[model samples]
Target: MSRSEWQKSTFSGASNECVEVRVVDGTVELRESDAGDIVVRTTPPKFAKFLQGIKAGEFDHLTT
Candidate 1:
């Protein structure tokens, strides 16, 4: 997938955010949107698990 096709998250409104992601070929690619050229890729399964953890509040202590 081309890096040019990656879209910045809509939630980043009015902020100089540091991240961007793209879904391609069943995997998700993450990168620093402003830094450019650096990327990390993860499979859908792992991403789903991360989301589940969030929903379950497993990381709640980190917030405090």
Candidate 2:
């Protein structure tokens, strides 16, 4: 899928600086707000694990 087709996260703050993501062929694609139509893809499992760790506070430094 094209980055232009990706939807912005509803949880995004007022600032338009957010990433858009989509699952394609068992992979997750990510792109920054100002990245235009370029996307980076990662394995679904890896993305899930990363998300789990983030929810578990393993990536708390990101918020700090």
Candidate 1 lDDT over 1-64, as tens digits, reads 4334677768887665657777877778888867677888899889789779989999999978
Q: Which window of 10 residues has the lowest lDDT sum in candidate 1?
A: 1-10
Which ranges in model 2 have alpha carbons more than 4 Å from their true place?
1-4
- Candidate 2 residue 20 Cα shift, in angstroms, is 1.0
Cα lDDT of candidate 2 equals 0.79
lDDT of 2 by residue, 20-60 (tens): 87777667888888875888889988988988997899988
TM-score of 2: 0.69
Q: Which residue runs of candidate 1 sit more than 4 Å off their true CA positions? A: 1-4, 57-64
